[model samples]
Target: MLKGLARIWFCWSFPTMLKGLARIWFSRLTPNSIDTFKELSAQFASYFIRGYKYKKSTTCLISIKQWEDEVLRSYIAHFNKEALLIDEADNKILVAAFTNGLWKDKFLFSLYKNDPKTMADVLYRATKYMNADDALLAHEEKPKKRER
Candidate 1:
């Protein structure tokens, strides 16, 4: 059963799932979209906090895949159920951010989550402090320099 689910999750349909998630992220947070910033921020904060609280403890930095996988697995173990408190949009955003291979030195909880405002502040700080490679377009690969 797990193998079947894995096969489906890793199949060609995965891209579609990512795309759908992206749409949700954009629609919820983008200016002039349906949801207000406060509403979207609240929704995002809800998930971000849950994910952070449930984040695995580690002395060393781990890959984004490891971070997310650990969080999901931990959720399943603790709750004895599937699906985390976070929505797919939050999951995709975190996965997309981490999968880009930037910010491997930092954990997801590095961002503040005391409240929605602090959380937004952390996100703002991230945009200003993190390198473009770390914060920008997850799907677009940075061009590699040619060796001399």
Candidate 2:
């Protein structure tokens, strides 16, 4: 557990923990610009909080399409990642968006044959399809035995 770690130590080490734009932002700051942890935290919040304030709507999910060559698993993963950023997205809307984005395939055919009412149902069904897709890929990758 952490012990004897003082505020000064935290202030000094904070910049090292940052990456990408944050690291660049910290590097650009004038030397000795931050005097206290509270001031540093406040400045960090003020600089980055604007981006966090704008939450994407469910409508944004409608624009996400499963690319021609993208696997079902990857598309579902990407869709789920973006879906998490939305605040209280409706289950029905999520299902619709997810279904709309999918291209014509076994999964899409399954979805059409047995339509899902909730996002959870859609994900559950997708899991089965993803496993099947993986199994098919594994089988295809195996070398065939030559006939004697």
Candidate 3:
């Protein structure tokens, strides 16, 4: 389905292409999109927990919880955009990644960009684990099980 759309999009003229892409991608701020984002975030969280045994994985583990939270918050904020100063290119990349279901690839590529230090720095900067004294977690009530 997406491949066919991608092929068609590839053949579109520049003006039409931007318009089509904007309508298809940036307009997805619905509940389904939120759920999809959450699922994608959990998938990334699981990646850090997979015991990949690589130095990068270990570094990610150090701030895994915070990173996941920030990612979710940032994504949602991008959708809402009340007053946050988010980068347009970053948002476009995010929307494109979400539209294509390439969450992991897009996220890691955006943050890390093939630089291990950059990845570590961004993670560290956003992480709260280092400041345990100021860290507080919201207690979310679990969703009730559906009656059969």
Index of the highest-lDDT prediction: 2
Clashing pairs in 3: none
Better of 1 and 3 by lDDT: 1
The C-alpha TM-scores of every prediction are 0.18, 0.65, 0.16
Question: Candidate 1's residue-wise lDDT over 100-141, tens digit each?
Answer: 433344433444223223323544555554455454665476
Give lDDT for model 2. 0.85
Residue-level lDDT of model 3, residues 1-148, one tens digit each, is 2467775564454225344324443344353443343564574456446733222221222222223335543543343332122222243333333323223534446544533243234435334332432343333445689999
Predicted model with the maximum TM-score: 2
Ranking by TM-score: 2, 1, 3
Evaluate model 1: give its lDDT. 0.41
Question: Which is better, 1 or 2, measured by lDDT?
Answer: 2
Give the lDDT of residue 83 in candidate 1.
23
Deviating ranges (above 4 Å) for candidate 1 = 1-117, 132-148
lDDT for 116 in candidate 1 is: 24
- What is the C-alpha local distance difference test score of each model? 0.41, 0.85, 0.38
Point out where model 3 deviates above 4 Å: 1-14, 19-119, 129-135, 140-148
